[model samples]
Target chain A: MDGEQQYIKNVDADAELVDRARAGDLAAFGELVRRYESRVYRTARHILGNDEDAEDVLQDAMLKAFQHLDSFQGQSKFYTWLVRIAVNESLMKLRKRKTSRTVSLDENIETDEEPIVREIAVWDDNPEQRYSQGEIREILDTAVASLKPIFRTVFILRDVEELSTEETAEALGLSVAAVKSRLLRARLQLREKLTRAFKRKGDQILGYV
Target chain B: MVTCKDFLRELGDYLDESVDPQVREELSKHINECPNCWVVLNTTQKTIQVYKGMDPEPLPEGVHDRLIGALEKKIKSQA
Candidate 1:
């Protein structure tokens, strides 16, 4: 079957599972958790910046989702609803800490009247190939971790999880415009981080040659 | 004609296909003519693609089992 047909099939299956779980079939709920656990955990990990906290958030969110299963109106996908709970749980943890890691939406990338690429070396190597290197993956993780929470979460939802802009906005309770703006910032910041790391590596290679 | 500034501002919307058709056409036109903007857009797109391609860290086996076990216990207690 094609992608759309497969998606429909999955949705139908999920709906059945939701109905069963809502009717107090714990096994059905376990199946739902199995399907979504990775996604929920990853979102929480990105938001909370650690495994222990993310695991806690994951468990808490799952329990809360189970307890409130009746309130799930099916207006959104079950996965989206689950992610919203996970994100809220993660954010509550962040709020408990005194340090607020918020990115300014007003922060703008400087643009020239006539834009010119000055120092950006053309990266001709296959990014997919380069990404497989352990060091590169480490750099990516650090770069993503460095982003302020708001932008990082938007990036994780839109880029990492591959959620649609509308779904991301819904998940975060933000406007589409806000999601777009934050996503752009996140991409730009990540690009800058990766570029700098690549440049440093290039310089080191040159020095060793 | 969309200037580089306008293009930068709306690049995300253009990429997302969320902009008006006319604006998208204009942005496409600008990118076609502007090498710098082209590189910026290309690299940014590549960055997202690379990030997407990375494998998600698997949930540890211990944690996975514990989570399931805990949920099952909670359900039983409530029963």
Candidate 2:
């Protein structure tokens, strides 16, 4: 494996780092961060929806992880444990912040606010087409940004980070039913956004009401 | 009448394959017979497929490194 892949594999294993960190090896703890930093940061970013807050949450989460490292017996994977800490810390920070409240669409709505829709189109893999990737990613970023903090956290953990429902429930301190409920709602909201965008773009020329 | 709206409301669970077998069997039967419900099911299914296709946004450059650095610093200061 290349150095990058090897590093990723090491992180995924969570073996060497857990053992070393338990023994108070600072470098091993650093490796744990290397392994899960992006996930933690992204989860924070999605929940908090601001770079500065996400950064603060990331720092706090790191500190908490370090302080509580001893309690992390290998029952669950290291990332799951770490993520639970990070997500809870991030959500706590988010709750403390004064953010606007958004509505959850339990059923279809009649509003014109086009939910930010991300189109995941694959063209021939060309480095020059990086612009397209940025556009689609921005759409997803916007869609995520539009969600309520709790739903955003659930979606980011489940869909983006690929955490299972049970793990996500543990991380967010939500029941499995709550996780499933929020996930279904989040998926519906995201779908509405994309559907509106596609329909608008496709039927724009017709100009029908 | 089992309206399309009702079908759409349960569409999330149906798509997840989370509905009970009895409900699933009934819904399948309804969708098979009812064009409107079927349309709703098709649209909802296609919409979910599209959403799931979205790529993971790569983390901001230096984010991982910065996080690791911050973590290491915290661990060191405590030691």
Candidate 3:
């Protein structure tokens, strides 16, 4: 693995940095930012669907994490704590969007009562490998961008960030049932969306997926 | 034999293996016997796998510098 890969993937490595950071080591805190800034920025970027708002959230979330360093209990991994802050900040940004096309945080939970089961399109066994990384990134980003904020956030937290259901709930102020409901739909929803994007035929458009 | 609705109801938990053993077994059996549900389960799993495997994109140019510069300025002022 590359050095940058090790820097972020080693969650355990953040502990000593956090200790130094708490002791007024600004450089250590900067190191912590180096480790997580991409992740935190991407979480915001994915949630907000634009760079301008995401940049604002990244700065705000990092600044907030720095100012509140003393409150970090260390019971959980430091990365998750950073993520929780970034997620909350992203959600706040979502709420404040002035566009006519805004999804309320509670917008789509009614699907929880009776989930939709469609005629799913079976994808190629390894659709991801068929595309270059940049192509896959664009495909997935467009697919995720199509989801409503309600389902999108849960899917991002649980699936993307790999947070536990309970932690996802706590991060979003949602119940476990709510998180699961949204995540299921998000998965199924993305499956359907990506099926179209991934279709080798490229000539058909239908709801089967 | 678990009904498709029953299988769908327990799917998220089934994927997480949080369902009761009996329910999980039923869901597993149902998927084995059912093509449509199997497709749903398989594609859904793959969808998540695709996303989880995506690497984090680097921040836009100057974003890191701008953020760190602003923070450093703030800290310096407070000191």
State model 1's lDDT: 0.80
Chain A TM-score of prediction number 1: 0.83
lDDT of 1 by residue, A88-125 (tens): 88888887763655433233434322222233434556
Chain A TM-score values for every predicted structure, listed in order: 0.83, 0.74, 0.81
- State in Å the error of residue A186, model 1: 1.0
* Residue lDDT tens for model 3, B3-78: 8788777888888878999878878888998877887788778888889987777789999999999898888888
Q: What tens digits encode model 2's per-residue C-alpha lDDT throughout B1-79?
A: 4554455556667887888998888788878987545544554555455446665456677766676677767656766
DockQ score of each predicted structure, in the order shown: 0.42, 0.23, 0.61
Candidate 2 DockQ category?
incorrect
Q: Which ten-residue region of model 3 chain A has the weakest summed lDDT?
A: A200-209
Task: Tell me the tens digit of each residue's lDDT in model 1 across B1-75.
Answer: 778778878878877778899888889998899766776677777778878987887897787887888788888
Candidate 1 clash pair list? none
Model 1 chain A worst lDDT run, 10 consecutive residues: A200-209
CAPRI classification of candidate 1: acceptable
Candidate order, DockQ descending: 3, 1, 2
The TM-scores, one per candidate, come to 0.87, 0.72, 0.87
Query: What would the TM-score be for candidate 1 when compared with the true structure?
Result: 0.87
Ranking by lDDT: 3, 1, 2
Residues A14-100 of candidate 2 have per-residue lDDT tens digits of 877888877878787777776677778877777777888888787788878778878887777688788888777776675566446
